[model samples]
Target: MALQPLPILPIEVLRQAALSRLRAGVAAANAPDADPSALKTLYIPRHRFEKLGPERAPLLHVVAKTDGGEGLSHELPLVASVGTLHINILLASGRAGAVDLDVKAAQLTQAVCLLLLEDQTFLEQFAYVEALRVSMEDGIARGDGGEFDVVLVQIELVMAEGQTQFEPRLPPNDFAQVDMTTDIGPVVGSDPPQDHTVRLRFEPEE
Candidate 1:
């Protein structure tokens, strides 16, 4: 018998799930009085993503500074190093096409935070922890008409000695190094190939 392919959710579904995870983390960090039950009903339209691409945007592309908002400036106490995480999600027309989602760094950071919360053991392995910072940078185009949605997530582990203050700093490269791969298979009824789930793994430099 032929093997059956696994079911993959829609891109919008995945996006909403990711956003939910982000909201949960923010609530846990701050606003203990903030009702999570009410928060779940909060829905930010996809159009808000456009604000993230504008020049001189705020630290995080979130609408408010509340716990449910983007946790961009929250600092984590590190032992001896600075750790930075980034998450980027893009929805393009198709492969070989222009990038519709241009916020690369910020998206990566968000993904990293989600990953950390899901697995606290991974965080303990590191020596130091500091403020979690995320940024979105627009990428240059190689061609016109052609477009692709790409999500890049990155985590940076900066090693340091004892008594080092973990300040929120941007990577000199403007963005953390990233490796992209598909977490979920192609969509059920899509032309060509469309990955419903994209996974980005981040490893700090030695």
Candidate 2:
């Protein structure tokens, strides 16, 4: 049998696409009862994490930065594990509106996982072993912000080998690190929340 090439996607491209979908979901969930304007902006500060060990191990020092020129801010840990990619989101702070932002955010995370698995290129490289592992730790916020404290969203991706008997045979397990950052610009600071949407695409890695 001819050897097949491994499937892969540009980390940044995938991250952006996932972020866009997340924004869309958030907007849809928070649509106004009356006139609905397009979702204009989203801001995802630079986030970082430290690997603890294996799948069971916990990630440490996950942080999110804001353009507000504040000191390094931290949030609860969120983790996700796919084939080989582990994703985590740490939310620093957010404007609490009427909409269930946390639930919408979780949905956004799942959407990203679905996209990664459905994408043939990504699957080829890192087969969809199972739903990405997700965890949302208790978050905290500071300053006289709106409603919610800085929410922390964390995701972790794990790559592992699987049985070949399955229709989609598992590929070699390897580890790679990728960072996803999203920026939704300012929105009207009001009640009932504002609606915002963004579309993003993913491309194969070169």
Candidate 3:
């Protein structure tokens, strides 16, 4: 018997793939009316939030980032497991033209969600596990300025492992950790295979 290498993809490659697709989706929706030039899409490299000035109105900020993914039971020819990726698509508009911006943002959100939910492979490699449209109040916009209404479209992806990156863990609650070290195999070395045990954790996120 032999072990086959797993199919892996660069994390940045996957992130950009999702970014481009979403940009296209929003672009296709247009804004308010049939005017294709009515909407503009911008990319922010950091995971933090940013404030949009009056000049940046009628613009969409596409932010993409990822975290370490959990592993899955894989077989031969697939030595590694895919991790979950989260991409946040934010829709924003300045206070001056805020009325129409809301409608436009909603439309863009709809388009992006519909395209992602399609029953086809994304990035020509990974299949999206899920996508959600959530509303974020005050947190995303920093700096003291007229409030900016932002709509968040969060997308989840499962792709092959890449460079290690981890999501900020809510510090472990005041609970003792369990020893997951398991013992298994034949009894040749005085180790009983049938007497093996497994552990499980069901604590809620803090």
lDDT of 1 by residue, 54-121 (tens): 12221221221211112333365333222233333322234544534444334435444555546554
Q: Write the per-residue lDDT of candidate 2 for residues 72-165, one digit (tens) a residue.
A: 2244222231233345543333454354546655655565556456656544543345434576765444444433443344565544323222
The residue-by-residue lDDT of candidate 3 on 1-206, one tens digit each, is 43332234344555555555656655555555654532245444333356545334334443334434444333222223345556555555545543554565566555555665562655454533433534533233432566666555554555554333334456658865544545564455453445455556555545
Using lDDT as the measure, name the better of candidate 1 and candidate 3: 3
Best-matching candidate per TM-score: 3
Error of 3 at 50 (Å): 9.4
State the weakest 10-residue window (summed lDDT) of model 2: 60-69
lDDT of 2: 0.41
Evaluate residue 65 in candidate 1 and report its C-alpha lDDT on the 0 to 100 scale. 20
Question: lDDT scores for all predictions?
Answer: 0.39, 0.41, 0.48
Between which residue pairs do clashes occur in model 3? Answer: 68-165
Model 3, total clashes: 1
Off by over 4 Å in 3: 1-11, 26-54, 57-80, 94-103, 119-124, 127-135, 138-206
Model 3 scores a TM of 0.44
Which one wins on lDDT? 3
TM-score of each: 0.26, 0.36, 0.44
Candidate 1 residue 52 C-alpha distance from true site, Å: 25
Model 3 residue 11 lDDT?
49
